[model samples]
Target: MDKNTTDTPTEYYDVLIIGAGISGIAAAHHLQEQCPDKSFAILEAKESFGGTWLTHKYPGVRSDSDLHTFGYRFKPWTGAPIATGDEILAYMKSVIDDDGLQPHIRYQHTVESASWSSEENLWTITARRSDTGQSLRFKTHFLWMCQGYYQHAEGYTPQWQSMSSFKGQIIHPQTWPEDLETAGKKIVVIGSGATAATLIPALAGKCAHVTMLQRSPTWFTTGRNANAMAEELRLLDIDESWVHEITRRKVLRDQALFVQRTKEEPEKVKSDLLAVLREHLGNDFDIDTHFTPRYRPWQQRVAFIPEGDLFKAVREGLASVVTDEIDSFTTHGIQLKSGKHLDADIIVTATGFNLSVLGDISFTIDGEPLNFGDTITYRGMMFTGLPNMVWVFGYFRASWTLRSDMVGDFVCKLLKHMDANNARKVTTELRPEDEGMTLGPWIHPEDFNPGYLARGMHLLPKQGNKREWQHTHDYWLDKDDFPAIDLNDPIFSYAR
Candidate 1:
C-alpha cells in the first residue's frame, strides 16, 4: 500500500525479485525463512498484489484448479476446493502479512530493463515508478523473475467484422467495467475456455439468458466446491496439517491418473466425460455438438465446473451453448455463420490471453541484447547462458504453486551454495558437447495447445533433448529430481 521508503542513495540487495505476484511472494517467503541473512526486494508493476487473481474481476471468476495443491505448501488452505478471486487474493494477502513482506514490496515499480555486468558480478536494474514518473535504479547479485508469463496490458480479442456498429455493451473479462449492469439482459459469451465457463454460470442468475458461443467444444470436468475428504478428516478429529497432506496427495494422484488415461485411452476418457455431461443435462441436450472436442483431454487444460454449476445453469434453461462461427456483429447482436442471429444486450469476449515472458522486460548481458528464443531453458526455471538469474515457471498439468514453491526453495539452495563456496557468480550455459543435442520448443508442439502459449511460443526459451535442459510437467517427477539436481553440473560455470 505504501511506496518503497528506502532512504539509501543507491539501494543494493542480494536479490531483486520482479513482480509481486504469487511467485514473487513465495520467493520472498523462502528467502526470509531459508536464507535469513540475505537482503532482497520485490518490485511489482501493479498497484496491488495477487497478480492474476487480483487482475481479473469478472462475474464468477474463480480458480480452475483446487486450492489445496494450488496453495503454498507452507500455508494451509481452509476454504473450499475451488475459490473465488477475492478468496484467493485474501489468501495471498494473508501470506504477505504473516511473512512480514510488506516492507520489501515496492508497488508501482515496473522493471523496464536489466543489464548484467560480468566485471562487477551484479545486475543493474532500471525501473520506472508509475505514480511519480521517475526512474529508479537498483543493483543486485541475483535477479529472480516472478512476473507471470503473460502480457498484462491486454487480452487477446480477435477483430470481428463490424464490431464497432454493435449497440450492445462489449466486455472483456480481463478488464470488466466496474459499474456495467447485466441484470435482466441477454448476454453472449464468446470462447469455450475456463473464463467463459466461469462467466456463464455466474451471470445466468441475473441475466435473462446467457449463451456460450464457441467455435468448437472443450473438455470439462465436474467437481464439488467443498472437499469431502477434508470434511471427513475433520469429523474424525484429524489435524489440519494431516488433512491438507492427505487431500493434496489424493488430488495429485487423481489428476495424474486422469492425465495418464487421457494419453493412453483418450476415447475412454472422452466417453466418461460425456457420460457425466449427459447425466447432468439429460438425454435432450446436444452433447456431441457442445461438449465433445476433437483433441484429446489434457492437450488443452480441462475446465472444471464447481459442483456442476455450469451444467445446472444449462439444464435449468438459464444458460445454453451454441457451437458456431461468427460471421459478424450485427446492430442488435451477433450474426452467426449458421444463418442465425443471437440477440443480446451485452457481449462478453472471454477469448484468451496474450502470453509473454518476464513481463516483456528487456534484458542485456555485457552490452549484448538477449533474445530469449535463441537461448535454451535450463531446468525450466533458468535460461541457458543466463547468469545469476532464475525465472519462476510452474507446471501446466498441476497446481501452479506446486512448482513455484519448489523454484523458491531451489533458488535459496543456489544462493547458499554460492555463499558457502565464496562464489560471486553462477551461470548455466549450453556446453560444447551438448551443442549436438536436439533442440525443441519449450513446450512440445503436440503436447499442449492453449491459445496463449501457441500464440507466443516463438518468443519463449527453448528446451533440449537431454533431461537437464527440459522441463518436466509432472509434479511427482520434479519433486524427486529438482531438489537433488547436482549443483556442480558441468553445464553450470562458476566464477569468483
Candidate 2:
C-alpha cells in the first residue's frame, strides 16, 4: 500500500474493488485465493462495512431469503434461516476478520470518476476522502464493481401534499431514528413492500396500533426461522462443513422448485399462497383486498413472513391493512381516496429504494464519456465495449449471494486466463456478425417491476436478443453457463 501527500497523488494496483459490502468482500476473497500474487484494494464510500445490512437498522430488519442461501458459499452460516441485521453484520465482520481483509479495505474512499486508457491499458480513478475532503487518485489494470443496485443516500419517498402540516413526526425506514419513541403511538406505515411487511408486525406490539396503507397488495409467503435438517444434523454431531453443505443444497433446491412452480403454474401457486394466508388470518378477514395481488406471482419479489408473525399480529387486532389510494395527508393523518380518514400520531414511509448502477460513478474511455444506456451488457456481468471491468449483479429471483459467488469465481478465472496468456487487457465488444441481433431491455418490463428498477431503467445497460448479451434471472442457468463460458469467444476480444 502507498500513500502520498495531497500535493502529489497516484497509486497503482492489479485490481481495485469498489464497495466493501457483501459482493465486494466476496470478490476480494476470490481474487486473493485464486491469484495470491496479484495486488488489490477495496474502496468503500461508507465509513464502515456491511453495506445494505449496515445501512438499514429499522425494526424487524432481517433477510427475506434464508441465510443458508444468502450467506457466502465459502463461509457457513450457523444461525437461523432468517437472520436479523445485527446477526448478518456480525457474520460479515467475522468474514473480514477471519480473512484479514481489514488492511486492504479503505473506507470513506468514494470513487467519483474513472478514465480508461486503451494505449496504456490502465484506468485512472479519482475519488474523494469523505473524512478529509481531499482528492485521491489511483490506477489499476482491472476494476471490479460490487456496489449493489440501490442508491444508499436515500430511499424512494413520494411527496404528499400537506405532509409538513402534520404535527407528528414523519420518518423513512432508510433513516430510522435511534431514539424513536413509539410506545402507545398510533403509527401509519405507507407502502406494502418488504420493509413495510417487516415493520408492521414489529411495531404493532409497541405501538397503540399499526396500520399498513398500500395502493395495491403484494404476495406474501411464510417461512420457518430455523432449519429442521440442520438442527437434526447438529444433534447427531455431524461435521459442521457437511451440515452446512447439506442444508444449503436443500434450501436452494426447495426455493428453485417453488420459483419454477410459480412460473409454470401461476394459478396453483397463487391459490396456495392465498390459502395459507386465509388459514392464518381466518375467514372473516378481507383476503382479496388485503392479501391478493393483481399481478402474477414472482412478477415482483414475494415478501416473506417468518412464522406468520405479520398474520398473527393482524389476527390478534394489533395491526391492520388498509388498501386505498392516498388523496393527501391531513394535519392529523392521511385521507384516502375512498373518503376514509386514518388518524395517526406518526407516519413512516417504507416506499422503496432508488436504484443505481455502478454506484453512479462517471466513466470515460479513451477521453470519451461512456454512456451505459448505449452499451449492451455482456454475459450479465461485463459491459459490451468495456475492457477489464466486471460488475456483480445478483439474481432477483433467488438469493443474492448465489450470483455474487459466481461472479467472483468467474472474475478469478478470467484473471488467471489473462495471466497465462500474458494479455494486458480483455475487452468485450460487439462483433460484426452480432449486428443482426435484436437489442432489448436489460430486464423484461413485465418480469420485474420494482419501483427502483422501473425508475432507473433508462440509465442502466441494455441487453441483446442473444443469450450472451442477456441477463437470465434463473440461478440454475447462470450456474451452468457463467463458469463454462468461453472467454476466447469472438464477442470478447483480448489484446496484449
Write model 1 residue lDDT over 286-388, tens digit each, in one string: 8999999989999999989988999999999899899999999999999999999999999999999988887788899999999989888888988877899
Worst 10-residue lDDT window for candidate 2 reads 1-10
Model 1 C-alpha RMSD to native = 2.3
- List, residue by residue over 1-496, the lDDT tens digit for candidate 2: 2332376458899999999888999988888888899899999999999899988989999988889999999998999999899999999999899889999999999999999999999999999898887788999999999998988889889998888888898988988999999998999999998899899999988999999999999999995789999999999999888888899999889988988898899999999999999889998999999999999888999988999999999999999999999998998899999999999999999999988888999999999999988889987899978899999998888898998899988898899899989998998888898886888788988888888888889988888888888888788888899878887888878988
User: Residue 490 deviation, candidate 2, in Å?
Assistant: 1.1
lDDT of 2 at 104: 96
Q: List the pairs of residues colliding in candidate 2.
A: none
Per-candidate RMSD, Å: 2.3, 2.1
Q: Which ten residues in a row have the lowest lDDT in candidate 1?
A: 1-10
